[model samples]
Target: MKKELSAIDAKYEAQKIAFGPMYFQAVVALRELGILQFISNNRKGVSIETIIEKTEVSEYGVTLLLEAAEVLGVVEIEDEIVKITKVGFFLLKDEMTRVNINFMNDVCYLGAKSMTESIKNGKPEGLKVLGDWPTIYEGLSILPEPAKTSWFEFDHYYSDNAFPEALKIVFRKNPKMIFDVGGNTGKWSFACCKHDPNVNIKILDLPVQLKVAKANATERDLLDRIDFHPINLLDRSQEIPQGADVIWMSQFLDCFSKEQIIQILENACNASSENTTLYILEPFFDNQDYPAAHHSLVATSLYFTIMANGNSKMYRVEVMKDLAREAGFEIVETYPLIGDSYHTILECRKRA
Candidate 1:
């Protein structure tokens, strides 16, 4: 039932795959040299000679990079003048593209070389490029400068913009105490305290991350409203604290395997009273409406396998719902793809 590709089309596809790395590096070079921005500003196209004059790189390097970018549809050349194409404009200016590019180049590209071995070994073999930690989260605070910046930028770009919208939903019931599980960097906890003067937050996370989160919260004088509970979620014996009105996990569970997630959810249940509500925010790959969004999530799963954690991924919504059900929770409401954000918030409660 599949349509066969024409010989020419097949060859084109094959060449794209074979030359992907070269094309990616060419775009990186073009962007790095300021050539893309230069051509973009020109609009009417600028002479290749002018680009060579403007950048420190050799004329040979400029020509080669631009020519390759042309083939990649990132630029165009006519009458000795080069112009930034639509693709090039996105590459240069789009926030999503910029984050993705930096994340790929600085964080994942080199590490991805060990992906095959990581898959075969069921471990983060590629993570050796970053550190010796079993997972990326443990080494997050110490990852080399720009790579660390790129990694957090990529992570926050997807999660932070959705906070205001999510806050409205989270605080709809006027919960007095919110237990923010896997509360990295304290961004959510800070937002919660600022949202409601009467509200307090307890952040549960690794000691290293909690230290940074506490410092960030303290800098804003939010430490009084925020509490830190340093505990490893992997320690099956350690449990989430009780007496919270709402339990929150935002962009967190994807960092864990299914079994670990189930255990965590069960711990949440143990910490929850019958009246307590649990909120889970995640970007489920299959729940994405846009092909581009789905593509990015699928690619992110590979990052989990090769560098983040050997067992986690951007999961399907149904799979997560099933796990929650297995852990004695029932979905009371579902907010899918909230406000231009690729995240879903599942409002769940302990099943009676």
Candidate 2:
């Protein structure tokens, strides 16, 4: 009798394993409901008849889709009336919306469909899907109106949170001058001036982003204290203004390869004096073999590589120290700040 019971359990497990394909069908059904809310604004919950009339799909197909969405808890349906759930409504809200959904639908979703091929080939197919556009920024430039806006809005949201925390970690003491390398929109520099009334801030970035940053600084009453410098990081021969006590490189290094990073560091070293501090802040990935590092590191690294053409692989603290040493400075200290993110404040003293 016990043996027969064990066989029944094994059959149940097999059935459960066979249900894996249902997962993607469920995702598609939920996406349909999200689209419905996006279109209708969730005013009167979209019924099967309404969906059939509005979408390319038929009434029978609408019913099947709604049934799947109901199981996924994206919507509630009773007496042939359908309504978006709280979860569904929140998902449609401005802050919480899946703004990337359209981008996914147009570009990434198709690439995801070929994820199996990517795994087999050991290289992503996304770049090929975005042919002739050498970078993600270049590809985004060609996208139609709302898609480009949505992508940048998402970028702004992340920078908004990251810049403030990075400022706190780096600008603990008020300094006379700060050089904000690659400072987009002057958010970090503005925050610094607001925190320390006596501090003067300089922002360096592309002319386009700097124009926006200048406008923001003017609006914030920081135009006098904050200055914008349009400079390319690749061009090292251009003179970097001297005598800045703090040089900030926030979320900038990951955009370059190690060799390029070394070149940038070398230039920065030449610009600094004995009392200068170089503050580098980025999302840290522990490169050690220890199982103790946070699980988010792996996911963060892969997403940057595939989507943004970034490499977030962990670099040893010793490597940074060695770079500083080669550049004719001694690393005074390193500090971690604000959650698990590593904000290395490397204070380098110029060799006499």
Candidate 3:
């Protein structure tokens, strides 16, 4: 019993010592392997020699990386041959994979090193780590070569996964038209069209984002039914496109202040008709004692504020109802969308 306990204690102590440095070393190895880009280009698998040659690293370094990757199940090694695993293939194939890598490498990794400082300060130094770029997209734009490609990968991941789920929950029945607010890349709009053939989507977003949205819509064969409208939310005179039965705000409102949210709500109210319904799907903050809830709230809330100049506060269900009421709308219902977040539908009628 004493021998077993001693062995266990030693193992725990060793883990404590190795954990931090091992994680850091893994990041370095990833960068060295050109893993993100290699996976993106090949999508099959690349040998250690190929990685070493492409990344201009030594054979010794490549071997180390291959070993580490095999251990992490990122790569499979047999008979001195290496191949990407299923998870590895999925990560590389997904558009947002690279973007996520860049985010982790540039922002999260560096910021995590100073986690103690952030904990003490009660905020992240994401802006500082990200440099001159204001938004996540802007930061991604300036990334070197393959890293930029990774950004596209990341964008696709969020669009492919999050938007579809949100749209399905929000627009179960076919609607004639949908105004997708902050509809970058028009993924959600495309999703709406996919869900219901009769649906027409109008995407409202920043000019650059609108350009991307248009391209994405075209690629998805949804350009005919989807139109892009360039409008800054801060511009009060900006007209909200009308004749839409659904006003979709998928992953949008969280990127603003209370006043800004109210303004947007008012605009949505004005744009909506008697039969129009406003849909909002976003991460819901649950005041639960569970670790998952706590981690999500803390991590996401901090991320929005520091990185995007936005609030990640999970708005109360009542808060939305009150906002809608003030803006001449009545709450229909709020329910959990497939995952951790909530979906809210607000029905509006113009004041008499």
Candidate 4:
């Protein structure tokens, strides 16, 4: 929303966007090849000859990537000597940055090429790059190599940190049974079980996800208190079973289009009693205080377009509230900025 760019600066920025892919790959190569780390270690700056000698990459490869990195502001070069910039330091060490770059490199990089096709067809046309599946969720468990590792790391990084704080809110009412809707891998379910020994978790998700979740539960010796009800939440014929004091969906609803979200929430309401409290944990862009955090959420929208459902995007807070209202739920309380994480928990109750 900042619209004060000078004409020349705007033109230069446009070119940056045009060559963004090249810049991104260069940075990734530098990181993977240890060239970035090498430069980082030599704070006084390393010579091009030293980088070429110390790393497996050729002199030509090192110089080209370093040149691109310099333009990208990831490194600074003076008198043919290279040193890691502040940005380079983050690229090397920041946990969130590491996850984001890995996800882009492993999961989204190939699929991004089909974005226009995906937009035109309203399907994940790019998903074919990894394997065949309706959406990324269905194929997550079987994703080959670094894709599987990077995908789970990316997905879990955002929601896992918020789990501990969410547990406190969920346990306050002393609920015995909580339904984990779209509970991928039963991570949140495990957290709930550990928080209160008596609480039971019934996870409702795709059969594929439940398979992994159930296995994880069994491995942790928590399956006795946890159960699974496999259902394609998108199917109108399927509804979550009744009898629970809490229904929770963390980082889940944003995976669906607004229309789908309404249906999903309506179904959640159908399974709820007058006393049931529905909790939705999402990192709504509007709720983020920093521009970079907001930027990351919006960028994730393209992943949905090209690789995920191809219909949903990271949503604004007001838009989600509207969807929840139409679904016959009202937000009674909100827990924002939970535990140094960008996630916000919407504590909702069924409207009379």
Candidate with best lDDT: 4
For each candidate, the alpha-carbon lDDT, in order, equals 0.91, 0.62, 0.63, 0.92
Better of 1 and 2 by lDDT: 1
| Candidate numbers sorted by lDDT from highest down | 4, 1, 3, 2
TM-score of each: 0.97, 0.63, 0.63, 0.98
- Whole-model lDDT, candidate 1? 0.91
TM-score, cand. 3? 0.63
Q: How displaced is residue 113 in candidate 4, in Å?
A: 1.4
What TM-score does candidate 2 get on C-alpha atoms? 0.63
Question: What would you estimate as the lDDT of candidate 4?
Answer: 0.92
Instruction: Score residue 16 of candidate 3 by CA lDDT.
Output: 53
Across residues 1-352, which tens digit of lDDT does each residue of candidate 2 receive?
A: 5555588889977875576346335545556544445334645665566666766666776777677657656678877778877655654553624543444444444445444554455444454555444335435545455545765664555345555556665666667899999787576787788778889989987676787788888888788899888886766775567788988877666656566677777777788887788876654455323333334344333434544444334455566667667766676666554433333445555555
Better of 2 and 3 by lDDT: 3
* Candidate 2 ranges with C-alpha deviation above 4 Å: 1-32, 35-147, 156-159, 162-165, 287-331, 337-352
Q: Give the higher-TM-score candidate: 1 or 3.
A: 1
Backbone clash numbers for all candidates listed: 0, 0, 6, 0
TM-score of 1: 0.97
Could you tell me which residue pairs clash in candidate 2? none
Q: Can you write out model 1's per-residue Cα lDDT over 1-352, one digit (the tens) per residue?
A: 9999999999999999999988998888888878788889999889989888877678899889988988888888998899888998899889989999999999998889998898898888889898889889998888997899999999999999778889999999999999999998998998999899999999999998998899899899987889999989889889888899999999999998999999999999989999899999999999988898899999999999999987889999999999999999999999998887999999999998
